[model samples]
Target: MASELHEAIFMAKQERHKNLFLNYRNLNNFPVELLKDEGMQFLERLFMKRNSLTTLPENLAQKIPNLIELYLHSNNIAIIPQAIGELVKLQSLDLSDNALQIICPEIGQLRSLRHLRLANNQLKFLPQELGDLRELETLDVSMNLLRTLPERLHQCVSLQCLTADRNLLHCLPRQLCLLPDLNELSMAANCLTSLPLDLGRSMELQFVFVDNNAHLKGLPSYLYNKVIGCSGCGLALQISDMKQLCLTLGDVTVPLPSEVKAIGSESERVLPLEELACRVLHAAYDWTCKDVKLRTPFLMPKSLLDVVQWPLGHCHRCSQPMFTIIYPKLFPLRETALAGVHRSTVSFVAYCCSSRCMSTFDLQA
Candidate 1:
């Protein structure tokens, strides 16, 4: 086995091969022959999956500076050397199914990285520096021990898909709703109780999966047609168990507010001053904010501007953008198709802008 591995490496060096495959080698350590003297500068891709290698060389980048792809899946690697950040040209990296506990902050320096997979690890937290990957498009951190994802992750403006399923996540950062290019999100089998009210408001977000979240009692109105999987949700948890889980998760258990603010009806004619102002500002922003010429003089205070930009949610009935306040109505999960064939009973909270809209609102409609 050693002779065969050495022969393969020698042949690759002689031919100046751009790609090297050493998968399923049962090797317990990185071959010293590969890193001796000046490394394979011409190497562009390296495949070492299903190996017994436990750690990476500190001079891996210095040896193979041109690496564009690195696949180290199904390894016993526990720590990624700081030199990993030196792979400035690395575009794809897969460290899934390993024993990694903490990701080094230097990983954020991979400016050219586009794809990263760290699934099936023992990671308790990820570095906030991950947000610096402006080119990152897909991130998978599934099957870990994470309690929360970085709030700065919203800075990954180019991100398209994010999966953090089967973890200890109690709540997701509301800032994730700002990702303009994000399309799919999967956070199944967690301990979530509620989701951000503005989630799924983005036109690009078309699919969401939150199945098996036993504590998730309700979903936001914006996810009406977008939610893909929500089975095994709304399962009642014993008060003692709930309290214990909350304590275990620490401050991450603060679920998004889903209480019924007010029920709209035909009898309520007087709209609150705050609500009316918000509606007016929202309408004005929608109208003239798109036209540069008309937008010039419509200056709003920073606080009001922020509120109008990120509204509480949209009305479930009329699809009208709402800010600060919502006239909420609740419906049993069984009443909606989202429940599918599931036997568990949960509820979906619908938001309305006014009493008039609430009077005419229907969960089925």
Candidate 2:
């Protein structure tokens, strides 16, 4: 007696189906049964989400060479098969909530791909070849371990929306601003210190979310015309810029950056940080300050103060604790108050825990 899968396969062959839906199936392994027949030759879309798939079937390209959209969300997929590159016609691919560690460079072969989602994965670095996906428009790499993006990404001229929130990136690629079609960028909860100078040149850009980056004092001069989300941050932007901000809190009370010692030592070589216990704390600690006029900010977790051996306070402008509780640091955000005369300010505030991002004193409390 043929099983349900066999029946489905028979139906697909008989009807010459183009779309296949097999979601919510307690599938432990790829259903090789579906590929044994020639009927799948016409298959273009495949939905197999909510399954227990640990890995993709070998030779998936051989079975569904004509595939366009593939949905494999909520699976235990640790690695995408190299054969994935074979599906040249693939456009939309969803591999969210998987255990993937890295994206295969072969993905660059998908010239027709438009949308790609890799959120909620363990990816440490992306393959530079991904820039070859010229047709890609929307990309979500949020909640990953990415420290930097490939500069080659500038080649993806069609990108419209990019979301890279909750990553360890300390800076962004300037090439990102070269794209003329990009419209929206969500980079909240990152360690970015500054923005690309050409950010204002993108005619299509309309929305940006860069809040929660403690060291980011304000947008580049060019972005002053656009209103973006900027709460829980200190800025030197004019009051007009603050007023234009998107905030859930009543009014935007933007404050100046913390005090800065000098720009010389600030330009020192970069240092690697141990995996941060919390990126939120790291960014916040860098911007919290007792005096709103200061150039450096200090927002630290109380629990971490002792572990890092940071003193209560010292080098007030540098936010550097008296002791040797050091971590990776970035150049301070230089704010010019004249720019934000008409800005809106918010009252949302938090005190620093130790000096610098590890402030010892509470600025707000």
The best candidate by lDDT is 1
TM-score of each: 0.65, 0.64
Supply the TM-score for candidate 1.
0.65
**Which ranges in model 2 have alpha carbons more than 4 Å from their true place?**
232-365
**RMSD for each model, in Å, please?**
17.5, 14.7
Best by TM-score: 1
| Residue 208 Cα positional deviation in candidate 1, in Å, after optimal superposition | 0.5
Tens digit of per-residue lDDT, candidate 1, span 72-132: 9999999999999999999999999999999999999999999999999999999999999
| lDDT per model vs. reference | 0.73, 0.64
Evaluate model 1: give its lDDT.
0.73
